[model samples]
Target: MRFFKYILTLTLFLALTKGYGQDLDKVDRMLSNYPANPSSTEELANRIKNDFSNDLERVRAIYKWIALHVAYDTKALGKPQRVRFSYRTLAELEAKKKQFRKDLALQTLKKRKALCEGYSTLFQNLCQQMNIECEIVPGIARRLISEIDRQNLPSNHAWNAVKINGKWLLVDVTWAAGWVDYSKMKFHQEFSSAYFASDPNEFAMKHLPDDQKWLLTDNINSKAEFASQPIPYKYFLGKNIKLLSPQKGTINMLKSTGVQFNLQNVPADTEIAYHFKREKYGQKVKSFTKADTLSFKIYSELKGKDELVIYFNGEPALGYKVIVK
Candidate 1:
């Protein structure tokens, strides 16, 4: 009887651990083979409604479809066009806003491209049609390492907050769609599910919504604290790495003996390295891994206001500003 109980527990554990991935894979496969190229948001919403019964699955379908099909508009980013609509009454204003959102989504669908606003508005519109509660969250997103520790950043980005099973989950379809290669000035259509239903703590690392209520977590004390966090790349979150030390975005070398990083859940074979902006080649930082935890230290000649980057498996994973007092 005890043996049978132990086996049952192990089976449940395995199922709990692997079920989400299996479900996501099934959804991806189903969507990939879907025949219709939806010409309008209504048609797309209807297809999603018919195909997915659960709220989570329906939202996932909308997110996956938009992330895969839509391209980021690079030209619009440089020269944004604005239109003004005149309305006399509050009801008229509300109606116009609703119509405006629908128009934006349809425009994005027709063009197959959009800015962050377009991505978010389309997601919100589709969620509304599907009877899922969602909101367009406007905020400041720290994209570049140079933006670290900078004061009073302009609200430059927007994402979505979706309510599934009475819980608000965050989604960034704009980022999931792809990244803009600034060097070549091109948008790459690489679909990543990392931003879908991300942890509030992890999402707060780079995104601070204009409204404090949208943060969804009390771990981040204030906007200043959010601004003062190390820039985490998609790889960091994708791999589920935990940054355990130097929590502040800027490190003071003069006050501390040396810079040491304590990370958790790092793969044993992963190579870690770091370099300043002035260095051509990165100096490898030897890490000691024990039970999925890794620790490494950087002892180097450093000076004032240097940009320090940590590389994981030859990819830039984290960025911090180093200050020598």
Candidate 2:
């Protein structure tokens, strides 16, 4: 009788483990079977539902599929030779926006490429069809270090806010797809799921949602606060460095006398360096390292427009554009 009881316990353990294992297996299957070309959205949605039993898993599956499959559209993002907007009035603009959103999903799927708006809309549409709550929040994305000081820029970016297990999560599929090679003006495929369900505070560093509700945190950031926060790039995140400072790279010398920035979690042995106008200026830059935070200061003597390139160790990490009056 004791032997039989032990056997039954072992059987239950095996069954439970397999039940948990099914999620991993399902994800593998879903990813492997992902279509190379466009397919019926409804059919794809049904397949995702049938594969994943839990809402969180479903959301993850969808996010992973899009992040791995979709390519960032460089042609669409490149600056055009001419500026033109067909809609002159608010009513016409609204109509055009409505139609544009309608086409984003289809165009993205067909081409397997998209800008941030298309990526966010595609993610939202997939979530909705799968009975998950998601929203596309349009706002400012300060991706380029040079964009830090620019003003009067329209809402130039969009990202998704998804609710999973009753908690709001932020995701940027467009960025996850890859980063733009600034020199070549081309997109590169670098898959990362770090943006999936990212921390609200960290997400706020780079993305400022037009809607306050999408902040997803109790400590909401005002426009002034957002503008003051340092730009958080993937390099900073990867190095586990927390930035504090001018909140932007493009600083007007007239507005601010000196350029100062703060850093946290910097390694004791890791060397920080800078180059002013491509000339090594490590000795000229003042730095203080204490505990986990490192602060650097560089006095500005700019007569016109120039760039300050920052280096970590020996490699270029970030660049800042300086404008002087």
Q: TM-score winner among the candidates?
A: 1
Candidate 2 per-residue lDDT, tens place, 1-325, comes to: 5335434533443343244454644674667677766575566677788878876677777777788788988787755523245977999988877667657786777788888877888888888888899989898877665565455456778889888656677888888878888688788888765566665666776777888788765443477666554455565543445555555656666535666778777777666676667344554345797776788876555467776666666655566777766
Least accurate 10 contiguous residues by lDDT in model 1: 9-18
Q: Residue 39 in candidate 2 has what lDDT?
A: 76
For 123-189, candidate 1 gives per-residue lDDT tens digits of: 9999999899999999999878888878699989999999976778889999999999999879999
Global lDDT of each model?
Answer: 0.82, 0.69
- Clash count, one per candidate: 0, 0
- Candidate 2 ranges beyond 4 A from true positions: 1-33, 78-103, 182-184, 218-221, 238-240, 244-262, 266-273, 280-306, 309-325
| Candidate 2: residue 206 lDDT (0-100) | 73
Task: Tell how far residue 310 is off in model 2, in angstroms.
Answer: 4.1
Error of 1 at 315 (Å): 1.9
Error of 1 at 290 (Å): 4.6
TM-score of each: 0.88, 0.67
